[model samples]
Target: MSHSTKNSHLSTTVANLKPSGIRRFFDLAANMDNVISLGVGEPDFVTPWNVIEASYHSLEQGYTAYTANAGMIELRQEISNYLKHRYFVDYNPDNQVIVTVGASQGIDLALRALINPGEEVIVIEPGFVSYAPAVTLAGGDPIIINTKPEHEFKLQPEQIEDAISEKTKAIILCSPNNPTGSVLTKEELIKIAAVIEKHDLIVLSDEIYAELTYDEDFTSFAFIKGMKERTILISGFSKAFAMTGWRLGYATGPREIIEAMVKIHQYTMMCAPTMAQHGALEALKNGQKSVLDMKKSYRQRRNFVVNSLKEMGLDCHLPGGAFYVFPSIKSTGLSSEEFAEQLLRKERVAVVPGNVFGSTGEGYIRCSYAASLKQLDEAMKRIKKFINEL
Candidate 1:
C-alpha cells in the first residue's frame, strides 16, 4: 500500500504522537562506538538469582499458561502483604490488584479505563515522557504543570489548584520521579492531598522508584487519609528488582477502578507473563536484601555523579531518589538536545536531553547513574572534557 493509502486508516492519535524523546538519543547512541550511555533509565543490575531461579522452577513445574487475568492469587496476596508492610496500605488481593506487563501498561490501563474523551488530566513535568501521550491516547487532554527544580520538583498545591478545571478528571504523579529523582515529603503529600480532596481528583501514583530512594522513606498516596480510595498505585519489579526484561508490573486501587482496568487487560494483554509473575512473587518474598544492596550501590553512584558534576562546574541538585540526575547544561550555550547530541558525538558519552520530558526541561540533561561506578567515573571525565572544550 502507498503511504497515503496506509494513512487513510490510521488513528489520528497514534499518527500525530511523537516518538519517545529518550529513545531518539538512545537510538543515536546505538549507532555509535565506545559511547558510555547514561541515557537509559534502566537498572544495570541483573535480577536476583533467587527470583530468576523461581521463574525457572515455575517453568519446570509447567506453569507457563496464562495466569488469572488479575494474576495468581498467591502473587496478589504476596503483593498485598508487601504493600501493607512497606507502605502501611491495605488492598484486597482478589479485587484490588492487577498484574500488568509493566508499570507502563498499568498507567495506560488506568487512563484508558477512566478517561472520557475531552476530559483533562494534570501531568507534572519534567515527568516520564509517556504520560502526556498515554492520556491523549485515552481520549483525554493533558494539562502540563511544569514543576520547578527550586521546589525539588515537588508539585506545589497552588499549581495543582490552578491547573484544575471543570473537566479535570485525574492527576498522574510520579514520586521519586524520573529524570529529576525528587521524592515527595510527607508535608508535601499532605498539601497535595488537601487539594486532591477538595477537587475530588483521582491520582495515578507511579511509585516505580519507591525502593531506590536514598534520602527519605517513601510515602504512598494511598496511605494518606481518604486518598486510598482515590489513588491508583502503579508500580512494578522493573526498577526495584532489576526485572525490566521480564516485563512485570501491577496496579492496586479501589475495587471499582481495578475491575475497570482488569476488564481492559483481559481483552488486551490477558495477563502479565506467567513466568514473570512467578519471579515477582519470589522477589516479594525474598528480594529485600537484594533491593537494599542495589539501593546502596545506587546511592554511592549518585554521590559520585553529583560530586563529579559539581567539580566540573555543572549545577546539579542532589537527587533524593531514583538513579538519575538532572543537571543544567545551559551554561554551555546549548539546548538540551544540542548538548546531548554533541556530547555523544564529541565525547562519546550518551545522555538524554531534558526537554524530552517537557518544554520546561529545555536547559537541562538527565544522566542515569545506574551504571557501574567505574563507567560513571569515565563518563564524568568525558563529560567534563567536553564541557571544557565548549
Candidate 2:
C-alpha cells in the first residue's frame, strides 16, 4: 500500500486544486530585494480615517461580541439603503441580505449553499481567480467560458447559451473585472439577462468593484428587469472604501437564497467581525467623498499605466474600469508564464502571468495601477528596458 493513501487523508478535490497564480508570483517577489510588484489586485490606499475611527468607536462601546447570524440589522439596512440609492436595487435588509467576512466568504457561502454534486457552474475567464475553485470546492464542476480580448473580455450572450447544459446551475459575473479591468455595459448585461432567463440559471454577480468604474456607469445585474430573484449580488467596502483589512462584505438575493446562505454562515462564520460591520455601516452612510477621491486617483493612474505600456510597444487595452490593464506579450515571443517569470527575475518587477486566469489568457500579463505614479513610472522604465533587451 502507498504511504500517501494510508497517512494523508485529504479531500481529493482540495488536494488537486492549483494554487493561485497571482499569489505564486507574489510569494516569489516577497523574498527578493526591491521588487516592484504589480501582481496582487489589492488597493494601495489606506482605509479612510472616518471608517477606521468608526470601528474604534464600536470597540469603545463594547461591541465586541458577535451580532445576529445575518449580521447587525443596522449594517444590513445601510447596505440596503446604499444599494437602493446607488444602483436602484432594493433588497430587504431583514431577509435578503447577510454580512460576510469580505466578498470572498460571501461567494463561498452562496456556492456551498446552492451547488449540488455533479452540477456545473460557468465561470468567465480571464476573470477573478477564486470563482472556479470556489465552485469546485462546493462540489460543483466548473465550466470555463473564455471571454476574448477582442470582445473586451465581456461574457457574450451566445457564449452563455452555448455553454449551458441540463446540469448547468449558475454563472459567475465580475465587472470592472480583475486581471482585465473590463466593465460590462448595460446593453451587454441585458443580453446576458435574456440568456439567464431562458436557461433558468442563477447569477453570482461579483460587483465588489462596482464603485471603481472609470468610464461607463455600472449596471447591477439585479437591475435587469427580472434578475433580482435569480441573482446573488455580492459586494463590499474593500475596494471603494479602501477597507480591505476590515473584511466586511455582504450578499443580497431572493429571501430564500439569502436565508440558505445565512444558515451556512451562522454555523461557520457566525457573523462578520462586529467592529468591521460597524465600520462598513459608516462607510455606506458617510464615505462617498472618500470613495470619489480614491476613484479619481485610480483613474489617473490607469491612464498613465495604460498609455505607458502602449508607448513601450505593448498592446494594452484602455481598461474601462477597475485598476488592472491586461497587455499582450505575444510580440515579446514569450509565453505568459515565461514573460512574467523572466521579467520578475531580470527586472525585479513582478507581474502576474495572464495564463493563470485560464488558457485564453496565455499570451498576456496583468498589471495593476493601484500603486503610486512614481512606482508605476519606475516599474515601466524597468519593463521597457527589459523588453528592449529582448
Each model's TM-score, in the order given? 0.98, 0.98
Off by over 4 Å in 1: 1-7
Each model's lDDT comes to 0.94, 0.92
**lDDT per residue, candidate 1, 1-390, as tens digits?**
233335387877777788898888889999999999998889999899999999999999999898899999999999999999999999999999999999999999999999999999999999999999999999999999999978877789999999999999999999899989989998899899999999999999999999988988999988998999999999999999999999999999999999999999999989898999999999999999999999999999999999999999988999899899999988999999899999999999999999999998989999999899999999999999999998
| Pairs of colliding residues, candidate 1 | none
Instruction: Kindly report which residue stretches of model 2 are placed more than 4 angstroms away from their true locations once superposed.
Output: 1-7
Give the top-scoring candidate (lDDT). 1
Name the lDDT value of residue 141 in candidate 1: 99
Mark the 10 consecutive residues where model 1 has the least summed lDDT: 1-10
